[model samples]
Target: MGFFDRWRGREQRASIEDPRVPISSPNIITFLGLDAISASGETVTIDSAMGVPAVWAAVNFMSGTLAGLPLHVYRRTDEGRERVKGGLATILHDAVNDETSSFEWRKHCFDQAFTGGRAYSFIERSAGRKVTNLWPLDPTKTVVKRESGRKFYQYKDGSRTHRYDAAEIIDIPFMLKSDMLQHRSPILANKDIIGLAQAVTKYGAKFFQNGGVPPFVIEGPFQSPGAMTRAAEDLSAAVQKAAKDNRLALSLPAGHTLKQIGVDPEKSQLVELQRFIIEQIARIYSLPPTFLQDLTHGTFSNTEQQDLHFVKHTLKRWVEQFEQELNLKLFGRGNTRQYCEANVDGLLRGDFKTRMEGNARAIQTGQLTPNEARAMDNRKAMPNGDDLLIQGATVPLGTQPVMPVPANDNDEPKADAA
Candidate 1:
């Protein structure tokens, strides 16, 4: 049975009002938020996970970086490959539909993928089998099933259900389960770590919310429980009043003494713990610590290396996955001529000096025409700039330079000794 089907069955069973049913049942736990409770005792749902600054930064950095890139469709040709323009290319590079730009659509898709562990988009094609538009689908409402060696997507939308062939859906999963149809959510997989971060944040907030006072106990002699409770309330009022009045001294009765129950944030190493959690989050996303703005150990040289690492190790994998998925679903498995690719050159567009030097080297090595290099910088091409140029001073190692010979033997220079 599908997840929602099982959920409905549980709901129906829970509605029978049977006193024998345990409160710890799945439906009860889900309704009471117990299912979301993490090891640290913090509820770590998708929304709560995003509340952590480190997670927020990691997801936005990855998804936004991908969305900001330019995705283009290209065609294979005998003379290498050429970019395909218009039609599907326009949809991918400019706008997926009238309402959605390519960037927004890509960002939304990746946001879902990074958090929910899967993203889906519906490919709308014309009767002629040409793509016309791309529409985003909610991963939560969709279910994937395989039958007879073919996959199908069944999406529930309101009172209607839409079924689509696997070919019609663009599905990207963070990681597939054993069945290959269900996916493992990144947030769900590391809820303990995220929950710890959440718990620490809440602790810090509550600490400050109570005027920077830790939990404390009053040690005093009291004849009755009511007397002790009244004395505690009076002490609480005094502390709050002192804090509000900005007074340095907290006055208490002679017999009453406030004993702090827990260590201060500094003694508890909260700052270090937070930084460590940031590094853990970075690991979860395969990102460098610098990417998460945790530069405690970053130096200039390593920071530059981290930039390269991000493009090569982290971003390249995601870019390739997205490109392959696009190619497969949009063009089909048998397609060889048409494909999609993300222009990640923008990711390395760092300092102007560095970019200019790299472009110059490419031009001088005959790897790129002058005009092609100019296009990278958004500059107009110069006349005759289309020709590839190389340094004229260099020659092949084995070949000797040609020397001019005299037209006749008489024209040859004689040795001074002769």
Candidate 2:
């Protein structure tokens, strides 16, 4: 069947089987659910987890960094493959750039994939069977269910419901396991850390607001009826006024002794506790302690390596997931040769002098043509720049015999007398 026809069929089938609708059969029932809880009692969800600074930093940093990257599409041929444009490339590069920029779309995709373990986007096609636009779907409201070995998506958008087949949606799942149905969310896996972080944040806030006040016991020798009660009330009122107005003094009646109590903030080790919690939260998100502005263990040389580690160890997996999903779903089945790749060279690029030296070396070693190397620096190519030049001393690795050169006859003119 054609793409649109198959889509229509799936929609009709999904509508008929949709349990949300009122059907004559009494056995039918719809189970509306969303995965929003973790092992802890806290509500561990994408939005909630983002409230934690560490999580927000991790998600925002990754999404924004990846979105700024360039995702290029290439078509494979018998001889070689070349970068393609004006088809899938154009669609992905600025898909709905007028309303939703490509960077925003990519950021959303990465954010969803990282926090929820899956990201989804609805594919809009034109009458010519070309994908015209892409729209992100909230992973929380969208449900992925399988029936009769066929997987489909049911999305709840406000009052209306949208159904899409596997072909009509872009699914980027992270850490997909043997279930082959869904991916495990990193946020969910580290719910305890998130809860503790939030709890510590709340404690810190309360600590600052009430830190000046110290608990104490009021003792007096008043033996009259309601004397102790009246004294306690007056003392409470004075303390409250002092605390609320930031007063430095509190009056006490004669023969009354005030004993200070409660643990001090320093004695409680709140700073150390908070630091430990931040590091743990950072670890949960696969972020180095340094990235979260915790430079306790960071060094000058190690910082550069840490940045590289962030790109390679952490960000590469997310980038590859996006590339593979776009290649597979955007190009459709049987188009295995054509694929998309996010150019991450920008992230790994060095300083200007270092970059120029590396490019020059590449051109000299024939690894890249002069024109190609110049293009890397956004410089125009020169005449004959396309020619690949190699060092005169370098040749194929093999044994060769040297040949003798013949002498010119003009140099033997001195022997004419003989």
Candidate 3:
């Protein structure tokens, strides 16, 4: 089936299986009924987990940042490495296919990886064995299996099953299980943390929904269980009415006394708990809390350090993983001359002054030519900027300059004497 047709079918299937619709199959019932339940009593599926601000922020931050990076293909030359511009390079750097831009393709793949634990793309090659396009496959519908000691990707498209060789698919898993073929989802693996966040948020919302009142029990003289229930219902109505009327106090029967049963949000430290959950989510993605918008402990200096930490530790790891996977699948294991890479120089573009200063230093130190540095900022090169330059005063450390000898003291007077 065509991509859009398959997507439309999937959407239709999802709509048909709406939660409100009843299902008879035990498996479907269980899947719809008991999504990953955490100790905090919150359902922690990918959709519910994403409802938590922290998880949403972390996933979007990582995936969007990665997708925004400049990806390129390069060839190793006798002089140095130079970027390859056509064919596969164009497919990677611009559009994976005529329908999708490179950014959207990468973002979709990474969004799957961050949320579902795995991302996959089918690489289409022409008769000449050159990559023509990359089509993303839904991880939920794609299964990886080993047959005859060879790995294969089986993708389910409606009623049809399409199979591809492992080399034809680019697979990135958040982490692998012991079986190697199966993967572990970050959301499923750390559902408890995400669940707690959801639970806390729900609690806060319900608390406010019911007039900012903590759950409480009524104590008084009651003749029967039914009477106690009636008294409780009356008090609940009174509380809601008071809140609706914007009253500061709630009236109760003379003999009945109300006592709070559950801990208040402040006492339970709900805000602190939320912040901690954000930190935990950040940890799951190897990101700093600052990236997730948890600035409780973010200082200017440490946040700057965190930016460096993110690039060096988290971003670089994923970049290398993606690069290696692309190189292997696109060029084959035997090919080494051509490779793919993510250029991270754009990450520093936000700090214009600092970036320009660093580029100037590189140019002055002969580490980069003027034109090469200009290319980083997407500026046109100067006519004479191709040459690598260094400070004129810079010389070998131990070398001494030849000094012109001073004329003898009497030599200046020789003309006058004549």
lDDT (Cα, tens digit) per residue for candidate 1, span 115-201: 989999999999999999999999988989899988899999999999999999999899998888988888888989999999999
Please identify which of the two predictions, 1 or 2, would achieve the higher lDDT against the true structure. Answer: 1
Where model 3 places Cα greater than 4 Å from the true spot, the runs are 1-35, 396-399, 402-418
The whole-model C-alpha lDDT of candidate 3 against the native structure comes to 0.89
Error of 3 at 24 (Å): 22
Sliding window of 10 residues with minimal summed lDDT for model 2 = 25-34
Output the lDDT of residue 350, model 2: 54
List clash counts for every candidate, in order. Answer: 0, 0, 0
Name the candidate that leads on TM-score: 1
Q: Global CA lDDT of candidate 1, please?
A: 0.89
Residue 17 local lDDT, model 3: 60
TM per candidate comes to 0.88, 0.78, 0.87
* Ten contiguous residues minimizing lDDT sum, candidate 1: 14-23
- What local lDDT score does residue 96 receive in model 3, on the 0 to 100 scale? 98
Per-candidate Cα RMSD to the true structure, in Å, reads 5.4, 9.9, 8.7
lDDT of each: 0.89, 0.77, 0.89
